[model samples]
Target: MKHLTVVDHPLVQHKLSHMRDVQTPSHQFRQLLRETSHLLAYEITRNLKSGTREIDTPMQQMEAPVLTGRRPALVSILRAGNGLLDGVLDLVPMARVGFVGLYRDEETLKPVQYYFKVPEQLDQRQVIVVDPMLATGHSAIATISLLKEAGAKDLRFLCLVAAPDGVAAMQDAHPDVPIVTAALDKGLNENGYIYPGLGDAGDRIFGTD
Candidate 1:
């Protein structure tokens, strides 16, 4: 899939192994997720545009390369997505933060939006959408649709882990948006959960269950 990128960095793979264990505690799980997110962020933004600007260092004045475009927007798919926001923010502290809160409707198995608040100039900057898991893909698709309706142009998706089904669905819906994920697990189970996946990211991250 040209739109997909699975990060195979040794650190990312190693931390993800620990994250999959049922025995990993909530605090430890959250810590590993944050660390992994930081690594993924590094790879996702590696090609960000840069331009030279004059600057005065402690010793001398010279032109140095710096990010040239408008600061990016980091849009977190709420609750679970918040788990990765800390690490991403650590890397891009100046990025505009946005939230899209969606919950699944049990009977319909569709995502319903409860909240959405994004930066004003979404059309002018690159937008990175963050979520811990890409499961059924409905939420991601809906969130991206909402952002586009609100005028977001460039967009990318970041996730801790994704299932093949979710990846397929996302690719079909938004072919131009690239997906950066730590691991691509087997297909989803009958219940729409990724098999061999870190169970219930929201619950695990918050110690809710």
Candidate 2:
């Protein structure tokens, strides 16, 4: 993956547009998110390495390409990340699941960690961190830092949307970790929210105010 990837597939864009609409209900928003996530997962996993394995078919024997190495680890950045995680899992059922719980301090716009758990042998497998929004990028940077500390070397970040500031911050903090998002909006608002973003993803998905 490159330093950044924006998935502009029509289906992804269509669903994202609906998700951005305030009129869309929670159930519909959740459905759209799951559908959009599948498309994003396709783009993110496009570069994964593969090896061939001989298998006997009904008519003949042939070598079939299979994903190489251990199953990739999918680490959700808690709460809203679960929305994306659900759909990604539908695509990559074998992926190992993990979570890092962190909530932002509204006053400071910094991440505060409360929970962390991940698969073993993180150093060997590719780790993909999922979160819905990259606003200030504090939570993402902090989450990736912890994953690195846990021995995750090959890591990638996935989100539904991103702000310019957040992307820049993430790149500055963790240049090696590539970011894949549905859309990169203009920038953040005074309150650290992505402008024209789909509002609070967790709240929208869960029907909270």
- Tens-place lDDT per residue, model 1, 49-112, is 7899999999999999999788999999989999999899999998999999999787776899
Model 1 stretches with alpha carbons more than 4 Å out: 58-60
| TM-score leader | 2
Q: Which stretches of candidate 2 lie over 4 Å from their true place?
A: none
Candidate 1: worst-modelled 10 consecutive residues by lDDT = 43-52
lDDT scores in order: 0.92, 0.94
Model 1: colliding residue pairs: none
Per-residue CA lDDT of model 2 for 137-197, tens digit only, reads: 9999999999999999999999999998999999999999999999999988899999799
- The lDDT leader among the candidates is 2
